[model samples]
Target: MNTSKSAGEIRLIRLDRIEVLNPRERGSRVFEEIVRNIKTIGLKKPISVTPRIDASGAEKYLLICGEGRLKAYQALGEEEIPALVVDVPDEDAFIMSLAENIARRQHHPLELLSGIRQLLDRGYTIRSIAEKTGLNHCYVQQICNLLRMGEERLLIAVESGGIPINVAVTIAGAGDDDKAVQAALQEAYESGALRGRQLTLARRVIDKRQRLGRAAGRTSTTKHSHISTTTVIRTYQDEVKRQTALVRKAEFSQQKLLLVVGALRQLLCDENFVNLLRAEALTTMPKYLAERVWPNGSHA
Candidate 1:
């Protein structure tokens, strides 16, 4: 996070003056627990606040995080609370708040990734995103890479804990190369990271990518627009059967053509056959077969 524009100072601010720009709904039970904690142990962290001028040209503070704590303070009838004041844009403040929510594990896995993606979109450095989200730098970077390539399937798998991020990255980098993807999955399987149903899931995901593409459809996800296992299996089987039939037909045609070529080549070696063909004006053979029977276009 660009420190020059963030984490300015900690100061007391009126609770009524702070506007929760991106407030999340906390369960009643959770809210009560937070109130109890603050009452018993006092607030451990201060709320994050950024100043913005309203249409009336009056300065007001926007709450970036610490909603629970701020609420706890209000419940305790406290008029003012300590807030970490920062000077940043509304968008940056919102992203910071989202990162803080993710840090607390208050968001879905996809939401977490989306928040990281938003930060990356804002041109936040990987280290900066890691700092804001309280995530590992490598993890943030991996998420950025996955989002950049639009590896929606692998991203879903990663979020669902179906595969490792490294494995997903490997498979994604493999692109349309099935062999490379298979190799990457095989390595994951060998490492004991991917097994059993997850192994099957990995295969299916790769199969989906092969048949369709890496991107998930507009509204597709595991819960919605989900492709069934039987569907994927049937599709694979049908493709294999079609390909096998084509190869078999090609082989049969090649055998018949070779037999004809062999007989014609033998006839071309006979003086009578050559003379008879020359006399009948049906002497011209295809250049390919002629070259095959008579080396360097030489006549018998």
Candidate 2:
């Protein structure tokens, strides 16, 4: 981004004269808070804009950043607000705006990646975007290629933070090469980014894309989140834990049953106790007990 020749000088501009080049959708709660903050403390940093002359020879200011502050001023019934004027081309101005928006706060991984995709869709070169956004040139290239290939499974994994960007890149770079995919999974597993279940997930996703093609893969992949690469591994881990607990409980019950049956069989084998029970008129046994103790149907 080019530094302003104005050198921090703030100029007051009318609200009507400023036009936002790209209007972003902000939640009402956030917008209201912006309005409240400006009302209470006033504008801390001046909004940035560029002077543009329309084809009709009318001049208007193209807003490069600070739409929130601009809108807050309007809601506050203010006619003019301070702005920092910049002289740059439209694309540079837009990139500058995007950089500021991204740098303002931590963004959700999906939102940040989608924003980069939006810039790519706008025909900006990967190197230019990397330079402007302070991202690794290679990383930006990989992201552009992955998004271009419509590899939503890998992207969703990255977006969900289940897998890191580098891991996703590794998987996407494989692209129909089974050996490469296996190598990528091995790398992820060794690096601790992927566990056994996650490795399984990565393989399934790659296999689907390879078998059904990207269109079908994306369709089936999204309809059910249980199969999604992001949540599937965790879900499988939870299920494994539950199954192990059930098996342990079953084994415990089996042991207790064996102990009870052993004690009963031993007591029944004693002639003195058997004769005593008979004398007490207790010859009949429950059918289930008889079936277990004497398998030949001999109750006494």
Candidate 3:
């Protein structure tokens, strides 16, 4: 440990006392690169630390941040490295860890997602995580999406930045049906398909397959032979005529109903015309004539 006093205002401590916060389960190539840099250039920047008081009233320095750099220094077997000690609460320790990682630019996308998942598992909400880490809510939400992907090969690609974040998000929202998701992913990989296109194709294929399966199942239970060509043609022609008649009848009925409705609306709007019709019916009009003129019980 090499400690140099600068301005005598800040006390620098050794790296041995600093602990890692929210350690990642997966190994990071980025961390290896940082270790290489440290081996070549030495410890250029000091990591941040905070004091944590124990139940016995003894204060110990806990690493509030800079986990990657600390790991690098430890791997290099350095006896000590520079650190800054401050007072911080344990509840805020994870936030400091995230900040330090972000500042050092050592955490990869997957590692960052893993850390976010850790914080969430520890009961941190997305809003609180964003506030504490100084990140936007959307960014935190995106990381949370990656966590939702869980332990899948697609998630691995997402973490490695091989897959776009949006693509990963779409895949994550596919839910826990592994076979369907895997099939979609396979198609995507084989065809170099976009995520949206992949999802659309998958849905279409599934729907088509389901329809075919239902048709097949229905046919399998019934004993039916192929009809003769003449019979088929006759059946088709009959169906066409039937459909045509139905359509024409529907059109005619619609027009008739609309005309009747319009005429009734006009009669209601014209008080004079309605009163005149009513008077005519009440006078010496035949019962049949009156019924014909006002079929709906209206005066006109």
The candidate that achieves the highest TM-score relative to the unseen native structure: 2
In angstroms, give how far residue 283 of model 3 lies from its true place: 99
Tens digits of per-residue lDDT for model 2 on 1-300? 223345446789899989997677777889999999999999998999987777777667889889999999999999999999887888878878787665556444555566787798888899888888887788788777788877766776665556677888878887768788888888889889887766777777676665445433335443345446645676688799999999999999988877877887899989999999999999877776677777776644
Flag the better candidate by TM-score, 1 or 2: 2
- Measured against the true structure, the TM-scores of the candidates, in listed sequence, are 0.53, 0.57, 0.47
Angstrom error of the Cα, residue 216, model 2: value is 13
lDDT of 3 by residue, 80-192 (tens): 76776655567676677765564334455555655676778888899988877677788678767656544233444545545645555655565455676566566566666
Highest-lDDT candidate = 1
Candidate 2 stretches with Cα past 4 Å from truth are 1-9, 108-111, 118-125, 156-160, 174-187, 195-300
Off by over 4 Å in 3: 1-9, 24-42, 55-58, 71-78, 102-106, 134-136, 145-152, 176-300
lDDT of 2: 0.77
Rank by lDDT (best first): 1, 2, 3
- Ranked by TM-score, the better of candidates 1 and 3 is 1
Clashing pairs in 3: none
Residue pairs in candidate 1 whose N, alpha carbon or C atoms collide under 3 angstroms: none
Show how many residue pairs clash in every candidate, following the order shown.
0, 0, 0
